[model samples]
Structure formats: C-alpha cells, structure tokens
Target chain A: MGDQLIFTYIVDGDDFTRAGEASSSVKNKLKMLGVDSDVIRKVAIAMYEGEINMVIHADGGTITVSVSDDDITMVLSDSGPGIPDIEKAMQEGYSTAKEEVRSLGFGAGMGLPNMKRFTDEMNIDTVIGQGTTITMKVYL
Target chain B: MTIGEIQRVLDAQFLYGEELSDLDADFVFSADMMSDVLAYGEKCSILMTGLCNSQVVRTAEMLDIVCIIFVRGKMPDANMLSLAMSKGIAILATKHFMFTACGILYEHGLRGGA
Candidate 1:
C-alpha cells in the first residue's frame, strides 16, 4: 500500500450473530494488501472486541479503518449509554453486561483491555449519555 | 490431534465439519471467554468452549483456530453451526464437562500452545 487504505463499516446492533463482520472484513483486506499476519491479527482482535462492545453497549455504530505502510488505524464510534467511569471500564474483569450477554460469551470486561493490548496506541472519548469513540493504531 | 481424534477421545458428536475434524493440530486452547482466547497468542490450532454463540465461531475465524469443541454436551445454534461450517471449522460436542474433556485430550498427547 502507498499512504493508507481506508475502510468504513456500519456495525449492526440488532443481530449479535453478525457483529464481527466489519472486523473480519478489515482483516481480510489487510491480508490481501500483504500486511503482516501478526499485524492482521492485532487489528482483527482489537477491532473485533470493539465491534462486540458496540453491539452490546452502544446499540451498534460505525468503524473506520485506515491502513498505511507504517500502521493501521481504527476509529469506532457508538451512540449508547456512554461509559460512566472510563477508569473502571479500563480495569480488566469489570463488566456491566447483562446476564444474557455473559451467556453469549462476552462481558468479561476485557474489551477495552484487549483493544489496548493489541494496539500500539489507543484513545477513548465518551459522554455519559451520548456516545463513545475509540481510536486505535497498530504499527506494521 | 485431528478433529477426528478429539471426537474419539471425548466420544463427541459431530454437529458439523466432519470433513475438517480429521486435520491434525499441534495444540489446543480451551476457554469459554473469547477474550482469554484472543489474549492467548496465535499458537493453538483447536479451541474448546462451552459458550455457544456466533461470536465463538467468529473468534475462531479471527484467530485461525481450525476446530472448536463444545463441551458439556452443549450444542450450537443453527446460525452458529452454519458460521463454523462456512469457515471450515469443525464443531464437536462431548458429554464430558470442560475439564474432563480437556484432561482426556491432554492425557492423550495434545498440548497447549507454545
């Protein structure tokens, strides 16, 4: 790739089954662009976690990905009950997910942490009742 | 171990992915939570989970996990099975609990990821 490859997706909140489509698509695109396998994995995991978070907490949102020679950047924005405590949410294993969500195999409070773990840089912007936006970058 | 051998070990029922179950895998990672599995680097080729959801299949797809074993006699929903099938991921369910199923596989020579 030259400067960067850009991708935009709308995550659907209604269907949990389809939540990972965006991240999967991004992963595929990165692979096709000849990005490193480890880089692709990081993008996939971080974005996949963000996608699920959008569906579970934010009722879906939009994800924008920009791929460049040096790095991959993902911007995820969701309109939901904004995070009340960013610090608490950042702590591993602190989850406010419903029982049904936990049953489906999520809500371990690892979403934000995984995002941070897999990315070179990450930033979160949120309002208590409005929405939240997460930006993450993975160096190639 | 191949998916076929795992089936034989747990005496699991193949819910989908019969063709893929026979593929040999060097390692196995067992977990119900996708986050834990993701945190586990890309070493394990097989995944064992009691959680039945599309996300489980999606997680496998993301991590390049070749097979998923649903323990405790749990079965996947139609959508989940279809998703796994589309990804060429073998799905097997055993009557044994999570720990027992893993123990049987480990005793037989299947090791965790490096």
Candidate 2:
C-alpha cells in the first residue's frame, strides 16, 4: 500500500431510504480523482452492497475507506448481530433477511457474494452477539 | 435503439433528463429486485424497474447505467428524481407494466443485457 487517503462515513440504521449515500459519495470522489472506470465500478458495487447490509441486517455501522496507489480498501464495522456461519452466509441465495427486506429489493442473498465478486480481497470478523466487520479491497 | 425511440414506442413521459433523451443504448435490463440487477445485470445502459426508491438510482449509478424507466405507472418521488438527475441518469415513466414495457422494446429490436 502506498500513501493512503482515508474517508469515513456513518451508515444510519434508522433509515432504509438513505442506505447508499456513502457509496455514492465514494463513487463521486473516485470519479473526481480520475480513477479508471472499471476500478470505480467495482468499488462502488462492493461498497454499496456492504452499506445496504449494514442497514438491513445491522442497526447501523461505520465505514472507513482508504485510497492508495495500488488499491482501495474499505472497512465496514457494524454493532448488530454477527453471523453465526460465515460459510453459510457466503453461499449465494442463502439469506436470512426478512420478508420486508426482500420486498425492498434486497436480502436476495446476493449481497455478500456480489461484494466478493467485485473485490480482490475480503475478510469477515463476526461474533454472534457482538457485531460484524467486513473488509474489502479493490485493486487499482 | 435510442432512449427517445423507446420513449415514443412506450408513450412514456420523461420525469427528468430530457436532454439525455437522444442517447442510445444497446441493451436493456428489467427487474424489481435490485439484488438480481446487481448480480445479473451487466453492460446494460438502460434499467427498467417497478421498484421505486433511492437505491434504484444508486444501483444504476454503480452499474454505469445511463437511463432508468419506471414501469407499471410507477413514478419516483421528488427526492428520487433529484438524485437520479444529479447522477446524470435519465428518468422515464410508462404506464405499461414491467413485462409490457420490456416486450415493446424487445419487439423494436432492443436486446436483453443478459
């Protein structure tokens, strides 16, 4: 990693309507920075999914994004209930999201898989009762 | 086909981005589920959905989609419209349901994104 430019955002759990604000902000910043479209696309998609997950599954969380010469690193930390089975959660179409969430056009169990698909690296740290933190990186 | 052509074929109304009406797109993706859109929608320039929300515009932004058509007479509120406009995504609304709108476009030779 080269010199890093870090951006932090708070994902509000109370409002489902504002979930993607952070991702949108990051996308605009990356665009202004003249990053490649493909890299920006990947980061935007991965981070947006993480933001939605925070609002839907967790109460809310904080995200830290670091922009470097070689890659962009995103760390999403939430204080909501943690995943009991990371393995199961990784499976596509295996979602624990409620019916209401599905109606909102999410909770299709594609969030995690899509995040992994768009990022070069991903790691999840979770404790059942404590919370979850997901780290994802997209290489430039 | 051009977005303007699609608008004419469907008799749709432009809620925003009339300036972008002439833009052309090779592919179209229609769905109410944003998750499906994220997973299966690729290389689509126009997104047609009945699900109206801020996330819909956000999803289009992430995918680099240039246009959005709200189907089944669904009209996005002011907030959604403003967000879409700011992101430079043209917004269109049609009375035709999701299936009908997509079918009309397909009949006119617009292909699915797949």
Candidate 3:
C-alpha cells in the first residue's frame, strides 16, 4: 500500500500437495487488499503454475511476490536442473515432467505458456547445471 | 442451474460445502488436467474432474470455480476436503464417468462456455 508489499515463500519440492500454498495465501491477501478480481485471478494462476513447476521440475524453490500500486511482480527462483532450451520449453505442449506428475493432473506442458499468457510480462533466466529463475508481472 | 440441481441430476454426494448447494451456475468445465483448466477455464462456474487431489481444489480456487464434481465416484482426501472447506468451494462425488457426467449436466442446460 505505502511503498510495496512484499511476500516471500519457500516452495517444498518434495511435497506436491503443498505446492499451491503460497499462491493461495497471496491470492487471499490481494483480495483483502481489495485488488481487482481480474488482476487477482491473473496473479493467482500465474503464481500457481510457477509453484507447480517448482515442485514438478525444480524440486523446490523460492517465490517472492511484490505488490505495488502499478503492478504485482512474482519472482520464482529454483536451483534444480536448469532448462536446456528456453524456446522449446516455452512451447505450449513441451514438458519434461515425469509420469508421476502427470498422474497428479499436471505436467501438461502448459505451465510456462499459461504463466506467460496470464501475466503481462514474463522472463525466464536459466543456466545449465546451475538453476533457473522466472520473473512475471501482472499490471494492476 | 443451481449446484443443488446438478447434484440431483448426477445423484452426487456432497463431500463438503453442501450448504452452498443453493448457489447458481450456468457454465461447466470438465477436465482431468489442471493445466487445461487453468488455460481455458475462465468464467466456468463448475469444474468436473476425475482427478482427486489438493491441486484440484487449488485450481478451482484460482479460477473462482464454485464447485467441483469428481466423477467415477472418486473421493478427495482429508487435506483436499479441508482446503475446499476453507475456500468455500463445494465438492461433489458422482458415480458417472466423465462423459456421462458432462452429458447429464449438458442435458440439464449447463453449457460449457467458450
């Protein structure tokens, strides 16, 4: 409200069930702050997809969300196996998730695209054998 | 149609949020993949899925889907039920398969919107 409201979360990669916890919390907070429903929906969906990716691919990570007057920004960082090809990964049906993840109703290769679709700005930074960090923003 | 009517049409048993059954909805979206639901599921009031997990409830929460219908009589675990309860999203379990459940709701005038 004043400067920028910052919320951070540690995504547990081992527990798939708890993946969306941070996104849900942020969504509720945004609602309490009287953010527009459409904006809240965008943030929630993008953040939730990032959360799922963290669990399914990255094996855990950190998510930092900052809400400002102009827009809401989400930064998700993970130290997992970095993506090999950002272009291929961005494809709507390109996925490297395992079969087990598919059983959970995800790994449909729509995570990154969906994230990009719902957010106004999205950037993915990855280094092989290092990690990956995704930054997404949805204008308020 | 209201959630109560859908329940009656499908002979669904409420796993949670039966009090919210009186809530009305006209659009239905059925999917086993949460990604598909998130991608094209806007304005959909009810989500019908055979996938029973906490993410299903979370997906519904993100989409503002008021109710989830689990086909093939699949039941949600305690964690999912608790999550849905806190989110005020209703849960229903029906014995019909995905196609059957969707058809029944479609026949009852619940159309899937574009």
Among all candidates shown, the one with the greatest lDDT: 3
Please identify model 2 stretches exceeding 4 Å from their true place.
none
Question: Can you give the TM-score per candidate against the true fold?
Answer: 0.94, 0.97, 0.98
Task: Give every collision pair in model 1.
Answer: B4-B21
What ranges in model 1 sit over 4 Å off? none
- Which tens-of-lDDT digit does each residue in B12-59 have in candidate 2? 999998899789998998998898888878688999999988889999
lDDT per residue, candidate 3, A12-99, as tens digits?
Answer: 9999988899999999999999999999999999999999999998889999999999999999999999999999999999999999
Question: Is candidate 2 or 3 superior in DockQ?
Answer: 3
Candidate 2 chain A, poorest ten consecutive residues by summed lDDT: A1-10
Task: Please tell me how candidate 2 rates in CAPRI terms.
Answer: high
Alpha-carbon deviation at A129 in model 1, angstroms: 1.8
Question: Which candidate's TM-score is highest?
Answer: 3
Worst 10 residues of 3 chain A by lDDT: A1-10
Q: Report the Cα lDDT for residue B54, model 3.
A: 92
Local error of candidate 2 at residue A7 (angstroms): 0.5
Kindly list the per-residue Cα lDDT of model 2 for residues A46-115, writing each as its tens digit.
9999999999999899999999998999999999999999999999999999999998899999999999
Candidate 1's DockQ is 0.77
RMSD of 1: 1.6
Q: Just chain B of model 3: what TM-score? A: 0.98
